[model samples]
Target chain A: MDNLKTKHFTFQLKDLEISVELIEELARIDDSMPEYSRFLKEEIDSTLSLSQIEGGYTILPAQLDQNTIHIGDHCFNVGKSIANKFTNSTHIAIFTCTTGPLISDRLKELNSQGLILEAYLIDLLGSVMVEKAMDKLQAIIEAECTSKGVNITNRYSPGYMNWDVKEQKDLFAFLPENFCGIKLNESCLMTPVKSVSGFIGIGEKVRFIKHACQSCNSTNCLYRNSKNHC
Target chain B: MEKLFEQLAYCIEFGKINKQSPYPPNMKDQEGAGELTGQLLDQGVSADDILQKALIVGMERVGVKFRENKVFVPQVLMSAKAMDAAMIQLKPHFANNPGSQKGTFIIGTVEGDLHDIGKNLVSMMVEGNGYEVIDLGTNVKAEVFIEAAEKNPKAVIGLSALLTTTMNNMEKITIAIKKHNKNTTVCVGGAPVNQEFCERIGADNYSPDPQGTVEFLNRTVA
Candidate 1:
């Protein structure tokens, strides 16, 4: 097994370059709802201003045996869907990303004050922000891997695509305590609530799938597009 | 009086809280659900009539629209806000007559599942439909559900679990509630729950959306 090294990163909210249009698209809002469109435009700026994004990843040598992935001394029974996608992988990038606690705290505050609509919008905004941050982080990882002629596959998380969520503990084992200030509870839920963790396959033959929603069965996923073709 | 009811329903369906609220842009300065509800009560309309003819009718439209994908969460929440405004005017009358509600509903997110957006949406819809809702909040255990069911023997129970892993906990809670009282109607929902899982878990009903849950509850009471 190759020695593993964890890389950490912090980001300014501006680094994600989140746009109101992107949030509107994620929220399934269109030009017809002028009030909501205006509201999204107004809130996106303030919400992004308060966001504190951070992320990190650890690369470990890995081998796939049937449906299970052997990473260092730990074995991840990641299921056929993931194992099939990672067949060409020589290394696994275990990653965690979070939009920090401010957005969620604000959401809770709004909800407590009986501002449900505002809170819901903020909640959607937080999801977009964290995912956008992860996208930026993933791009960094991809760029670094590209320099070494190593390609990366689309990211996959434990709770999606039939992967057992309990395996989040095994995934977290690769990182230090509370890496990126995100903690996993016994139920495998992440704290800060607006955080995401997953794995990316890295190898010469591994390729990124631009639209992975087709293979995923999570139809109600927040990030899933309106057509379910994302 | 009929015109007032129609106007109030329109306000609620469009999510106009009051004359001062600037939503649904077309109805900018018109009297909204709040003012119209007050006027109807002043004109001798019973609170129950206002609820049945206006608020419930409006909320049902919102629910159907939400189910049809004609509207989304924020829009539904706005309608709920308008309903809240109208309900505030009717609260005193409802307090005087406790039997006016359709029935009782007990709801919560299953144990190990902290997500509550789906639960809250169902709660709001059920309440807007004139049911007395007892929300146990998120991460609620089977015992909590059992206790609530025991208190309101006729009440229907709703379980929500947004995580696939917590679906196991939902099944356990459903079994525990059924063990406590086999007659207690259990409805399960969430992003991850479906009719197939609901049947496997022994839940009485499963709804993919809040409107379906409302419809199930309406049928249970009927």
Candidate 2:
């Protein structure tokens, strides 16, 4: 029974260099805002610290419920809206990428001292850095899995498409303890405020689907119009 | 004197905080909003004119950019910071005389939602636009919002929630505010909130961005 196992991945800071463009995108600045670039560069050089952690699971044969999927000795009531995405999927990968606690702590300090704007901006940069780290992680997975002749789908996280946030505990259980020093509190929020957790689907025919913002129930998300990011 | 106000407005619009700030490369080492405000006051520009003519103009411009997605969080933040530094000098003037502020605003992220990024941005934008923003910080309960509104009877209350779960509390808070006093204008916004959610909760309105919130509040008191 223990032979059914999960693969883990960790990344070094230097291996993940968050690009200026990504930070700018996260900041939501479409124009060439020179000042934002200046501040972001300073933040990346001084305040930013990235740690990437990911875990993958090869699905075990199991049946699906109207709102639940039984796979690999675990069952997730992933809701009908999200289960629709998994119809043709064979395996699912769960991962978390964080900018570590350093940036989050610093943001709080900035906020308390009345540096609300600067703090909020840096917080956006942290999110972008974490996203870049995830990209690198996905690349590593794709390189290894390509030889296996399997296709990977875009990542989906909880709190979207009726996949309740409480299901985060089920997702985390498949990974190593305190994987990359990330933890979920009572609120299902990751310890590092900039951290993200999500699942990716793999199948022979699954290609990356363009995120359909309209299809998503959360119609008012700021990032919905810029759907490529998710 | 007019030139000084113009300079102050420009400094704030571009997020030139002070002479010491090195962010906006074009304005590096130049007198920013902070220094220009002090100089304008020293030259006898009234606090009301400085706020109405300089700071409000800058904030309104940034607000429009934010709504259009031309300026992101960082740019708005820089402008907010410059506005804050300038406000440090103007606070004393308003303290000595009443009615200097256009209105009072109380804002917070709803309970169980630790996210404050959105709330902070709105608070800064509202404050920059000549309102007195009382930020209750993140994870605020309905009672806290109600109490604050009670203390400042005419204050406009804003509730923010980034989490879908926490958005439920916004509805509760709005009902409590209306119950406490029907006239209080309670506005709501966040990633999970929309116009439908806003109206369902009986809130006065909803804004997608900070500038939109400022515009809504401006119209309410105008």
Task: Tell me the tens digit of each residue's lDDT in model 1 across B1-222.
Answer: 788888898888888999988887788888999999989999999999999999999999999999998888767888999999999989899999989999999999988877878899999999999999999998898999999998899999999988877888999999999998899999999988888998898999989888898898788794
Off by more than 4 A, model 1 = A1-4, A31-50, A225-229
Give the C-alpha miss distance for residue A89 in model 1, angstroms. Answer: 1.0
> Can you list each candidate's DockQ?
0.51, 0.34
**Interface RMSD, one decimal, each candidate:** 2.0, 3.5
- Candidate 2 lDDT over A77-116, as tens digits, reads 8789677666666777666676677777778888778766
Task: Tell me the whole-model lDDT of each prediction, alpha carbons only.
Answer: 0.85, 0.77
RMSD score of candidate 1 (Å): 2.3
Could you give the TM-score of chain B for each candidate, in order?
A: 0.98, 0.97
Question: Candidate 1's residue-wise lDDT over A1-230, tens digit each?
Answer: 12347888988776677776766666666554435656666666665576668998988899987788998788888899788888799999999999998987887788899988767778888888888889888998999899998999988889777688899999998898878888887678898899999899999998777656667788677776452335
Clashing pairs in 2: none
Give the docking tier of candidate 2: acceptable
lDDT of 2 by residue, B9-116 (tens): 888888988898985777877998888998989889889899999999988899898788676676887898889889999999999876888899999998777898
